[model samples]
Target: MSTADNNSQYDKFPEVAIAGRYHEAWQGWPQVVAALQEALAAQPRQKTVLVVECYHGVAQQELLKALILPLRPAALFDAADARRSTAEIEALIAGDLTDDPVFGRRSSLPLAAFFDPAKCAQMQQAIAAVSHGLVVVAGTGAALMADGDLLVYADLARWEIQQRFRRGELGNYGADNARADLLSRYKRAFFIDWRVLDRHKVPLLQRADFLLDTHQAGSPRLVSGAALHAGLRQVARQPFRVVPFFDPGVWGGQWMKHQFDLDPAAANYAWCFDCVPEENSLLMRFGDVRVEIPALDLVLLYPQPLLGDAAYARFGAEFPIRFDLLDTVGGQNLSLQVHPTLPYIRQQFGMAYTQDESYYLLAAEPDAGVCLGVKTGTRPDEMMAALAQAAQGEGRFDDARFINRFPARRHDHFLIPAGTVHCAGAGSVVLEISATPYLFTFKLWDWGRLGLDGRPRPLHLHHGGNVIDWQRDTDWVTRELVNRVEPVAAGPGWQEERTGLHPSQFIETRRHWFSVPVLHHTDGRVNVLNLIEGEEAVVESPSGSFAPFVVHFAETFIIPAAVGAYRIRPCGRSLGQRLGTLKAWVREEETPC
Candidate 1:
């Protein structure tokens, strides 16, 4: 490139150098200073170099001394800094330095004003006017102009240099790496939970099970039931049992033993309650996702046909399968349960069921266990016999039938198909992705336990029995669990295979750790960007509109369809290094008749 081109690039804050203990600081600072000094010394009389400092600091002091003092003919300070306001800094640089009080204060400068680099515009234009003489140095002066040009000085630290780097100011630095690292650490720090959830204060749990029990009447009435049936009689006709499970005793026997921490008998860990009725079943609504099943205390994320009718109409039409990130804190050895397949549900209950799901294990303690498919050679009769014995409180069914068992480990993903008997082990936080609205869990065994209310937890033996496919193809279950495809390539976009039975209903998601600018093509499909790892990225539209997108851990963003091409740019000093991004595209599939 010619000198003019080079000068233009450098003038626009083409490079940022962060000068600290790290060697990377030399990237943007010293180079720009040297270039400016060379140009100024060569054409001194004709061109006036204006160095504006916003305020006084160590870095600013050093910068002025090194670059301006060597060839200084004039000096200026921001008149605004002094209690005396004067003419604008612009007019003074135009050989009008003595026109007003602005010109007098411009002579005594500090370094702090430049702390905010955005204010360097006016100073740059004023200096450019001096064609060859009187290099004016002012505190709190503009170093950059509107036309994308910049002025540089020495004695600035690496952090300031890096800031200018993002504005297209610095050069020759591994800015992408620094930016990525900085962004990553910020995200990690921001997402760590510092406070634990107190059960008494949890709003959703309180709303689900508030009861008005009368000692005189002998039974309690769930307040939620009254709210549902008050005026919307037709809509709220379904009955529900809103039972809360905040006690440790109930969870210890049912699901806690398999988790990391042994149930603290004194501490109430499991705060969920079942919203079931004494006589009839009711629809349970939590947030957006709702289910029309027997009222059960289950943790849900984004609910299917999202919470309200309006939200359902808006999002359900485009994104149907809702998912939640479930964190099962204590070990849970749930009663052996089986979900009915679509065919079985349709044939037996005249209902459609799609229970295919996968678990992305996030955390697990030693001895963390999960019960997968039934034993390879075990038949329906053997399972039934074992279940009968267990129901009668006879033998330990877990060890007798040789049911498929495995220790849960972090990052391990297990795919559970409908009718494949399975249970979530204790001490695990799993990201459960499924294609079912119904949580139809048929309990085959529950370790003979009762709730705090002195009632034995009812088991759905018949429903569970009818759904267990005795002659299930074991190979299909194993294959789905073992097979997983990498979603993102090292370069761009994602590569995912059609592995699951309903692969068409699932989207291909790619995880990305981007540093430099990446332009992605959306191809007319709606995309969801979920930030599982990091924060702050600039999603710039093809039309040049850009917004700062912040992603805390587990936060999600739904990018509208027809978004076209977009570029992601990291923010702050850790622009490229610590920044992480995930891209997801909705999979198109024909609705089942």
Candidate 2:
């Protein structure tokens, strides 16, 4: 099928071409085995060694069960055997993986820190001893053994890793504690495991002979490493969408379930991580086979082309902006929350920036509203005491007493710079546009409800109090944060408005209402956009630099800085109809390098 055929907003699995065409890829075990066997056969009489270096959450045991007898290697060396003892790893990462519920210090440990030198040397010596047949040296750090006859990278997506963590099926690398708390596992992975793995993955992705998609347990996909790189480079030159993952939460609602055609069996769809590259994956279609790789690979391997000149120089390998859906329609209010200030986030969590964000209302019921900032005359001590008592179940937090609840309308944009307390109330579907420091939220109240895990959700009253900006009261918020829209430019059939993010935040948002094709330029920075009001629209390169991309309503697409210029207009069912798109980009002067 053509790439445009799957551009529907309800498409859960979106696939794109690699280098303008679907290259060859092997699907299932037999096809993968045939390809590897042919490669091994070309080596003639020499002892062939196969090295399978995996990401931390990959199932090594499953790979062994699938490849052990088929390859029939004379000897096998599992690289995990060389990992440091559990106690050693704990002591090593204790400082980085703190007890904080939603935060951790970023770790600087290298991949070499997780392995024992003597054990690795022993594994290398063992590889040398195998004189005949295939010698398989497998596991996450297997590449340290020796240059192999065939290097296969068994990669796992970060979202899949999180699911495995929630299911108690995985643990931090070199630490055999699979049954740790879900938040603890995520903390360690964020602070330590993923950091070291990415450092190791870059070199391997550059040199691996084959790339394997082991996302599913038994169904594995394989492709050449060069083809993988070519595909990533191709993606950097065009507009595309990452594979979005949805999850149920205590405050989830039915909006996404109906709008995105999500699984109806799920309790409620609270979040659709539509454009979070760090936790989402990309699918490259090669004929009938689809190979999945972490979206961050594109960021790491080709940050300049994918993220643009100024953005790459400023954020390095990070995708600075994120777009997600927060559904509170037909559900309870979201937890009253506050994000850390820049200095607080840097000193407390080792992050470079705070999660300064804005909410653009997608759909709102008759009574839809948002709780933002404190009242003009509210006292800090008075509000804190009420929140403390409410958090302890003494009474429900009195929103009317201290907070300003603004009536929300469709397309209304609310600026929420870091340190300003805010949350979307029930009866609204919010398109949350923000910086990428996603997990830094410090919740002060949770509406006296237990989490999906049947336990009370965590509260960070002390942290929230420390970071809350007392000056963002109702008077200031109404004057500055609420619906700060201004007409910027217009054409024969289109108009553009600057729908802010606050001046203190680095992200700048613009909304376009177009009935005819509207031109947009990347101007040396990446642009993230969504069709907020339309059935479908097509994004075309003015110079025919890449193929025309189609996006449906509520679907977010990224325009790489490399694209230079593109145009968008209503298409398919929405042709000639008025459409609206919300676009965000990093402000040139304000973005911290």
Candidate 3:
């Protein structure tokens, strides 16, 4: 479990050491504690016990201890002791927990259900008993209150929680196959947490008297009430930008390393989760205090505003689009894989939707290409047999003979609908835009490479075989999956080109090339955009001006549907060169599923 420390950016920021580790945390916890003290002072009760509620694995309980120990609360209710049995949680790993069709219904149930009923009653009794002395209630779901009580929400980024999971800080529920074993499980749990915790958020925010952002866990940001309201309103209406996070992988590339000025000490940067809200964070700065919350909070808080009526109708409260970078520039091909179809994923994995992805080639070397579908005449059974043989180390795979290969260059869009076999070959930087359903990829081959842990990577031959759409052979892939691009329209110094849709796709894509500022309307669907071929650009909207949000080369950004009309203009050196942007949105007709 000794993986590389992913967040080397901490070296450039002020850091504090806690729990035998150093982290890039703002030195703001004291301010938040002071605010809590002030808020408690106004309670006019001698027994002022603050209830700290947070997402699971957020180290806020430690923070609460540090903040409250000096006051010597008469009773400290540590709610962790009330957690449900691990066996019970593991038993329900594959059961749907929420009624929401698309999200909040996968893997383990929500943490709210993780508490033992008896322990919960005990905790409630403890809250009731505290009247003349100080009492402190702290943990996930600890702020479920009685009459006249103080509540505080300790927010943490889902990405940070996932990182902690990777470090084995969270308990293992038998997902020890690889480093990414719990990735999907964590995502599923997070969606449920959003449902379980978010309904109480508005009330908690308005009445809590204190709000804490503990993204770093060691240090928390305290926002004043006025500033919190302003920040929340801004987030509700403006274009949303999650704090981008990077991780190194077995097939990672160096393109992002050189482009984003990231820490180069690492071997390479693999995935830049630029705007996948479920696994990314949004830093909300209020005055000198800041708080980091899951980007999913926006969609949960303002479903119609952020995703619009059309998107909300289609995907419920979920943000349906995801944009991330898959860099193979100095590495190897991504695993030969096929995502499950919607039905297949639901039946086999308990997920509502499958990963329907598209690789928009942002840059590639001359020999770089994509391996897509199967060769012209390869049978589905034959491919499955070969995959089984390879998985068992029986023989070498003639990938060229078995998989169709096509040369890819800048701006090439390859549609990867579910069940299509594909992999982005080396020497390319691919901006993957697709449905938000990630972590269902059924890897068939890994070019005989071992993972970072020195173990052979896991392959889902049995599962993959069940889902491969064998008919998507070479001819169909070349003629259809490889996008059929055509100019759609043009305006002053700008033009729109439609990246043709594959018949199986639910998302529509297009690229905009402009030398001067150009206005684009969201038109009621969230837009996932990337500056595929530009140095930088400005994104301004009627809702608010995010001047110099300054998207650099290959950086992904999002425009929430709440920002109805927005303009993008070339910045820096791109003023002289035509700035190219690739964007994807849910198709209008496909929005009512």
Candidate 4:
């Protein structure tokens, strides 16, 4: 079917694009290629262009022929070769030459200059003149073309390289000069770095108006970043800053040192008086949104107690809630605990609390498992009795009535609602998204472990009992053990419900696997795109003009709200068929007998 006809099927959900880099030899490339082909086939012919930037080798030439030749003869133009003599490019721009005498009858699309700022400006002028056509720019060509008029940027390098180039580090080849030109050129940008973007400094590159990230695609990063950026952009004309959080060394991996110069010890968890004294918190404040919990260190980074008075004056009026990236390193099973809802927090703690949260499993050891809720048929009285016995040291009640206990595998996601008794298993790392600013926890049990300080970790038994929903309810948690099991029919870029387990909070969660041109949301909520397991994809939105970004394994990205629409195009091989056995297991359990 035609692209428009296919896209009509997924009209309900917002559109998003995935873009990144890849090597053909990687096992994931097959899947990436398949997905890209599908997206292209389903996308409107006029609206889609498979833009690829080659660093070296004959791969670019082969890939171009492989992708474009079979579909239709594409209008090809080389930015590098086009600049062989500045005179030729000028002649084309001046409309004196109807056809490229050098390349013969094949249509020579407008060639943009890379590295030369003046030529880059001329190319921008030429593109603005063309109402519609397929144009491909590669290498430095992509960056120069990124002068800000394109709607999407698919960056292939790590965030640091992009940052360096934006910071005038790439030989100062007038990097700052190019940036000044880009400031007004694009509206939104997306990166492959899944960690939270730093709000403290100026953004390295603002080429993207809307960014679609492939890192940790399952979390709330995109939506959160969008909201913060939009708010900050509105209040201040300064550019949003991008900060790196993950250190490869921590994961036993090696990354170039210059990518991000992060000194965990140097991070100050104090308030700065220069901004707003009362509302000061170490958490980096962008605009209305403040990220208090450091994703890497798991510490409160902003709004110190000393600044509480000012914080109250600035934030107390709106009572903004907080968001955290709760990290657990060792395996001591988290104390079985519960968080009081908003009413309870306000009544008991004398402060408002927003407790909604979703968990995205980062990494886990083979033995890690979590204890969630109670088993079916376990009566409330039995649970209460177990609680009492455990409190009195009369029984091993913690393990007996637990309803569901399962190993924590990599990438597993779980939603914990208020009043649900839950505990993170040992040897697992997770990204926790929640409503902010309350530290209320009621612990039901701890493995009798001691803290690093040679003391038993403190327990909040009295309060824990208050929030425990004694009634075992498994209705809210739905588990999808596998990814992309049912082959969704190919169509225009769209989102489909990959699993029945959906989040019930103000935010709704959906897993979509698409190979089509898609548009993103304009609503205020952030869109977090995690590259759970894929080759490469691109997210094009209305912010900056089209630029390239990379998405590798285990990385995450945040797409901001200012981006009006988005599109996704696969870049590498395809991810293989679903994990068959895992799919069966989940289906059997979710299916009502």
Candidate 5:
């Protein structure tokens, strides 16, 4: 949380303009340029073109003005010239029927048009014409990675982009749309860039002579070759914590406010995006200064090393899982919704994966419940009628009549596979663990409520109706979605239980309780663990492969598959209570190693 200066080696991270306030992004680029200069000297003399690829909204031109021009390269080629005009890009996307405002447009279409080979080749020829002097190609693309060229990548997290966009640094599409529409477009752009970066991340890191972490405010560092490899391995093999960001919602609750010691002045804390890499920051400590970057870098830099061989084989470079909190305590129910099925997601959003989530009840109050599936005998037409009524603001969509409400208690695990409509009811705090595709939730109803911004939240009734499996009625859901708890084994002061719900799922989840250090090994699969009922625990490897990692109650930490044998020992508080932890990993059957 304290991102400025950990050691004081560098000046304080500068706060950039953000939503009527200031937010920190990567430190100045001066140091980065200096380090890069040294690295560049070792590169072959024939490497005349220096391509600096960057993510969107990174102000690549500004970076050049501040750092690169001082070096005085002979010719500078701005890649922005090659990009299709905004009108052209929008026109191409408009042709696709799947480009839904609520579900989001496809990223591939516009990207394909943006990276046309003819445009890239034309830009490359212009750079080549600039004879013996240094030619700098600054912006996105790898159209010119010759044998002697130097490629540097500039990366910023999606969260930073959001902050800048809100402050108007990133172009607001136009003044024609309202704030909500602009914000929606901004979010849509984030997903597009995410897919683009994820696709080329590994190759860029492999090819680039240097990597610039531009996520933090004032401390920028260049990493390459062995240093880059070793540093990434260190992060992947150790217990890593990303900076968690909180947001308020219309149905926000106070549970996270008290538990996490968050801002009390705010209305309430609804979501704590603790470990979702796409929207979170990874803080790396370098001596007295701290450098921050998007957590997605880990998955991009070393997919097999971080996600394990099996997971990589199945999910490719995508981080197949996610962990976040949804608090309803002293608030109201989440919108009744269903995530798109795998095929539907791929066809509609051009995404390779879909969201299949499960709610692990962290805390529950009296009469707390979860809205799951539809009532036993509800017809498809009946379900649509109710949603239509709510969308018209005629009345609150009644969950009791159409949706199955199950009483929720602490530690209750409710599986919500794609196609199963679900929501967390009032008076409960839920830890949502699911597949990493998080933005595709199709809300059929929102209880006639408005958003925190005072606008009616966009509803995806059309998409939700198409995705919901009507056969997943009350009886089928009650029998299948409710997880079964079966004791697996017990040792001195320790016990393990298999708590998974579906056999077809990719992740195998289990609960562990221990009074002493529990010995465990990754065995070629990454593990995500949560301290369900413990004050704290120290995760250590006897071989000193990684620094000892500490996790507090309600905190989720990752254990990379590369971390072989390790032990988790209960620390300071709650010595009387058995420390409880829930761990999930790729199933052994799927993991050949």
Candidate 6:
């Protein structure tokens, strides 16, 4: 789908190099199959039990085909056979996977909840009976079937799973709802499947004999667990990028297709999941192949070094900052929305915090602007009533009468603390920097447009009304949220400025422009940055701890807290040009609001 990405410097499949000593990863079905055979042969046992546990969304049938011919196991068991029936599993998670189009109650269900005790016991007995040759137990929850002499974990990225959802090729675990509403499937995965599966996979990352990447069909990469862990350790000590994924949306536009060299055949590119660790992937280079793994693995495995000691203590293995693009450059306006407040999210959604976002206008047309807050004197009750009427198709919401519009241009920053009514107008490509709890946004309006499903999108007027801050009117927004930049520090050929994310937001943003090398310190917290301007720049360590890394225009990169001191300077096409980068990090120290 993204064949053109190869020609683009964006490096759609960015890869981090593993040290040569730990580059034991084997590529392709031929090499991967041989490696598995060698490992099993080396095991000192008359009868060997090989458990190949897959993360949900992996191609189970394909994996079995790849192994059945080579290993010629005497017996095999699919963990799926041990799961509860489809109807039973559906009933089990119905409460957490609610009827809401885009939201679901957070689930506390563990992986074991999806398995039937009797079925699991039966599978174990079957495994115990196989006393000779190779006995293979493979599939999601395979480890529950039996403890194997050598266990391998096959992992797939969340973004790839989302693509499978769009393509109607995969469904929720133990559920047959692939053709159901796209949003509902995503809701289930986000609220239940991923949560439970992640709980199951975290512990396995440490002890699995091998890590398998089956991202490509008929081709897989296998890395010894020790080598994989060593590679992750290397990643935690340098600058790297999560493998980005782009998707088309109802409000998607053409800017990304042209700017990022995206698939021209796609309708439009709406979002680029730049540095969102939750769903993005990490690529480790081995020989000529790039093996994909979830970026969350790095955060969960090396939280102290990847997130820094302070951020690890606060977020607890959660990646607190997120960066993505909202492209409306040649499309319709985004739904007028407001994210829930912290207190409301905590009590209602079981999230630790809410999304406090800022829009850095990466690119905008001449007429681009944003709808922010309400008119200076607008009353909450009156606006709510009008929104209620609009929901019922009474008439238009008369946004001009109640919503304050601010002209947005390239490089403009708009701070959106939770509860502020805002949406980027048409013709703007937004770099949305926010806290990681991203789905709490409640859409109150959509310009009366139909969703891609040919129905009016669901409205959350009641939820929006409860959280809307009427006091965040035209005057307050003008004073506090619009391009609130202050000079911080400067050096020859470089200048640094603090950009407003609002004091209430825990993520702090900084903008830097330079024509020469500019020094930076991670300050013991992970740093996420986007090259918002110019062509390219190189990030280097002062003491050469890691190799110099190059970042291109609009690509986001991360500096693990352990990276310590680093420097970035204009390079390639921008060697003598002034380039700009927008940087964000968790604010460990508090300041007066």
Off by over 4 Å in 2: 1-9, 19-23, 590-593
Please write out the lDDT profile of model 6 over residues 1-593, one tens digit for every residue. Answer: 44444345777878998767554789887888888899999988889999899999998788877765578999989999989999898899888887777888878898888999999999899899878889998999999888789899999889889889989999888888989878888889999998998888988888999999977888788888988888899999999999888888788999889877876888988889998999999998865657889999998899999999989988888999999999998987899999999898887778888899999999999999999998998988888888889988999898899999999999999999999999999999999999998878899988888877788888898789989888999889999999999999998999999997899999999999999999999989999999999888999999999999999988999999999999999988888899999999998756479
Report the poorest 10 consecutive residues by lDDT, candidate 4.
579-588
User: Which candidate should be chosen as best, given lDDT against the real structure?
Assistant: 6
On the 0 to 100 scale, the lDDT of residue 571 in model 1 is 54
Give all TM-scores, in the order shown.
Answer: 0.43, 0.96, 0.87, 0.42, 0.87, 0.96
Which whole-number lDDT from 0 to 100 does residue 417 have in model 6?
Answer: 97
List candidate 1 segments past 4 Å from native: 1-319, 347-353, 452-454, 470-476, 492-530, 534-547, 556-586, 590-593
Taking all chains together, the TM-score of candidate 6 against the true structure is 0.96
Stretches of candidate 3 exceeding 4 Å from the true structure: 1-27, 92-110, 145-148, 172-208, 224-226, 542-549, 590-593
Q: TM-score of the candidate numbered 3? A: 0.87
Cα RMSD, model 5: 6.0
lDDT of 3 by residue, 217-257 (tens): 56666554445555555675665467788888899999777
lDDT of candidate 2 at residue 445, scale 0 to 100:
85
Assess each prediction's global lDDT (C-alpha) against the native. 0.40, 0.89, 0.71, 0.38, 0.73, 0.89
Backbone clash pairs for candidate 2 read none
Superior by lDDT: candidate 1 or candidate 5: 5
With candidate 3 superimposed using the best TM-score fit, by how many Å does residue 266's alpha carbon deviate from the native?
A: 0.8
- Give the lDDT of residue 485 in candidate 1: 45
